[model samples]
Target: MAAETSFANASRRPRPLTLVAIVLLHLAAIYGLARAFAPDAVASVEDSVLSTITVTVETKQFEPPPPPEPEPEPDAGEQGNEGRKAVPREVVAPEPRIVVKPAPPAPKASSTGAADTSGARDQGTGTGAGGTGTGTGSGNGGSGQGGGVATKPEWIGGRINNARDYPIPPGGRQARVGTEVVVKVTVGTDGRASDCSVFRPSPDAEADAITCRLVVQRLRFRPATDAAGNPVAAPFYWRQRWF
Candidate 1:
């Protein structure tokens, strides 16, 4: 009976140790389940953090190359000569011209005195008192008349012989014995002689020089008028005679 009681005590003590071991095992199982749930919660928190952070990558763009330069134009001289050729053209005949003979000149007139008078009229001259005369001379391929009408410059007539008073230079009388001097006088609008030049120079220098001086100093004129009757400067040619 004592042996049976000792066995019962030993069994009871083992039962207490087993119960404690079971309690420890149950705590270990609970800890394993909590660890597993904690990992899921950590994953959820990391999802929010990852969603808040955004990363952007920048891309580079490349530019295309520029177009090439254009070629130069060709020179005009280097072009072909097709447009420069001479073209054949139609020809027309010209009309013929006629020739006619000219009439013969009239016969010459006879009678010396009548012929002399007719010649004088043709020369545009009239005899003056004392056989002295004035004439409408021809010059410069035109009439010496002013404004296209026959006219002559008049001298204040007298026996003064205009240049007689002019002091004769040495050898003047001998040099100018047979020669005549002609002078050209340019009259101004004011009716006064503006210039005097030797128109026909004489062999004698004294005669040429005296002719210009006598005309410029002693000659006066009525200024010629135009067709409109306006007074104008006219050129007058005068012949000087010395006795």
Candidate 2:
């Protein structure tokens, strides 16, 4: 009986639990993993643009076929109809193809500059922007800093822009001339330079002539603007001078 008890205990002693423990340990095993990122990493945005596409066209020209020769009329006893008051046929002229060139650009027109509204030394009237400037007038001021100053190409003239900027000749100066005269001419909305007098004049007659020329022919103003800032055609004055 004691031997039987020992055998029973040995059978129930958990059978040294080796293969089951190994399978459980294998199932519990886990693998390790690692990851890294750059310091300047940023999210990106995507955009799409539609491009203009054009289709290419090809063309072929064809020439007209020659006119058929007139059938000879039946002979009437060997008599030709050359003298029988032959009917006059209408003649068609051939169409000729010629290439045309583009026309040259028209001359641009410029007006006297906008009246300086700022209270600076502008057109030199003591009354401010509306006031005239000191000094007599001439064709243009002395040449500026560079050997030649830049001038804009004139093309804005409609009927005509009289205010043209004339370059003063390089050899035309000896010394500065006399007291400047300032004239305040009220110009109408039209581009014409009217009521012209010496707004500013040099002491010399030549200088004053510059003012007259500007008033009569060269001085132009953009059409006067209305209260709403829209451009309207009207008469305006030439406040010209040279010094």
Candidate 1, superposed: residue stretches over 4 Å from native: 1-172
lDDT of 1 by residue, 1-243 (tens): 999999888877757778899999999897677668797876787778755643221111112243487697443222122222222223322333753654332224333232211222222223222232232322225344535423434344222253344455576444445556666777776766657887677676665776577667766667776677667776776665554
* Candidate 1 Cα RMSD after full superposition onto the native fold (Å): 55.5
TM-score of each: 0.34, 0.23
Tell me the lDDT of model 2 at 62. 17
Worst 10 residues of 1 by lDDT: 55-64
lDDT of 2: 0.37
Give the best candidate by lDDT.
1
Residue 157 local lDDT, model 2: 35
Winning candidate number (TM-score): 1
